[model samples]
Target: MAGDLGLWGIPVAIVGGAIRVSTPFLFVSLGEVLTERSGRINLGLEGTLVFGAMAGYGTAVLTGSAWAGVLVAALAGVVFGLVHGIICSLPKVNDIAVGIAMMLLGSGLAFYFGKPFIQPTAPDLPAIALGGWSDLPQVQAALNVNVLFLIGLALALVMAWMFRSTKVGLTLRVVGDSTDAARAMGLRPAVIRTLATAAGGAFAGVGGAYLSLYYPGSWNEAISSGQGLMAVALVIFARWNPVACFWAALLFGGAGALGPALQSVGVTKGYYLFYAAPYVLTLGVLIATSSTTRALSGAPGELSITK
Candidate 1:
């Protein structure tokens, strides 16, 4: 194992792990970016994620098709997003509080429905082969990448382009920056926010589906470990940029894989600490970048959380 590290195998392992594990984070962070760009926060994304996992796994198990699972999970995510949008739009209702409630509701629903999916086996998603050039077994293992990673990267680029160059993106930014200004321009802030939330939910749902149908092929209570929540922090760390979200998610994925990679290489001491690397990194970044003054400076003016 030490020899493997000496041979630069660790870097391959890290890259492979990042590609595999970052899919969920990428989805969640991108979703959060969309929501925040629309001047709202959906803390309940954790719930959307878990429920999407359950829905995806259950659908795949029943329908025998991974695509069916993805579609169903996306639909469920939209429902969760719509619910969040409606609740947050109510007069005097705190969006944060509603987010928390939605989280509880989503998690509870997932737990209730996920009981059947806790079994040892389920249909897994097919992987696209991209390591054909590697002759060494370890190299192949380390080079193998999931197709979803490619899709995620493409989505990031698409989103970045949309945000930077599209009329719809301009309207979204305007609404997020100032609801009053948007209203003055005949744009409905509520409608924009609702649509963004729903779209974000769909992305988050796909993230959950990837978890259940690809990286880990079984459903259980412990299937997700705050990936959804950390994704929210990641979006902030990325400054609400979808492209940055992609890199941030990959970084977080590498952090997450450190412990397992070490264990695979015959080092297991401080395993628990390694498992916490992603969260610790998240906290550190938050502390470094977040401040009342900076929030006021960089955040959309109409965003209540920044205020």
Candidate 2:
């Protein structure tokens, strides 16, 4: 990053950073997509992301296995999800209010216990060398692919297919669209939503694992960088499609990497502007895609977000 690696290095750095940074966004947004699709929004995933980062790093430090840490992080998310689901399932409980409370609770618990794990070094996730044939060192570094990123990509494809073809997906859609209809069919909406929230939380947990165990490769209180919150908007921009979610995540990731990419090529002018790029891009996306006339094309009918 000292001086110029040349003009070519800018694109290389952006691509690399996009791949490296987008993993968490992809996972979290997908998780939110799952949650929102069930007509229950979990704004607390920010706290879930933080908790996962702390729990994953702490577990990795204690167990000497990154995978074990991942499992622990997922389990932690499941617990939080169960708590949210149960509370929100009660009569007159607001899902959004519960989510806010869960966020505070999850984050407070993480900050309290995560202090000891702040400085520990944990195992990093392995990456694929997709650029080995390239002579440029920048290319090789840029194309280094983490395994979790690949899994996220595959899961997006599978999710897309499942929503169109699977019985479980149809059931979720039914429950999301109308609780009364589900109850009439002898299906329990609470049970379905609870399970969906748990599964959504698991996805967010994996996103947390990627944050602490892969790209940044550390345990820190500020590891998430609002990616969890931003993911809620990302799901909206993607129209709740799993496949679209993946691409939107990459776009956000690339926007996030803009500052570092310019810096890598010896451009420091207005560096702070680059840091704010993602937020600006997010605003632009919201504006470009905004419509007050009708619900977003793919949004669930019973989703209470705007109503």
**Which candidate has the highest lDDT of all?**
2
TM-score of 2: 0.96
Residue 111 of candidate 2: its Cα lDDT? 90
lDDT of 1 by residue, 1-307 (tens): 4236553665667777888889999998998888888899899999999999999999999988988998899999999999999878878988788888888898999999899888846577777767778666666766666667788899999999999999988988999999999999999999899889999999999899999998876788888899998998888788888999999999999998877676666665775578889889889877877675555345566666787
**Candidate 2, pairs of clashing residues:** none
Candidate 1: residue pairs that collide: none
List the candidate 2 regions with Cα displacement exceeding 4 Å. 1-5
Candidate 1 ranges with C-alpha deviation above 4 Å? 1-7, 296-298
What are the models' TM-scores? 0.95, 0.96
Summarize candidate 2's per-residue lDDT along 191-215 as a digit string, tens digits.
8898888888888888898899987
* Cα displacement (Å) at residue 178, model 2: 1.6
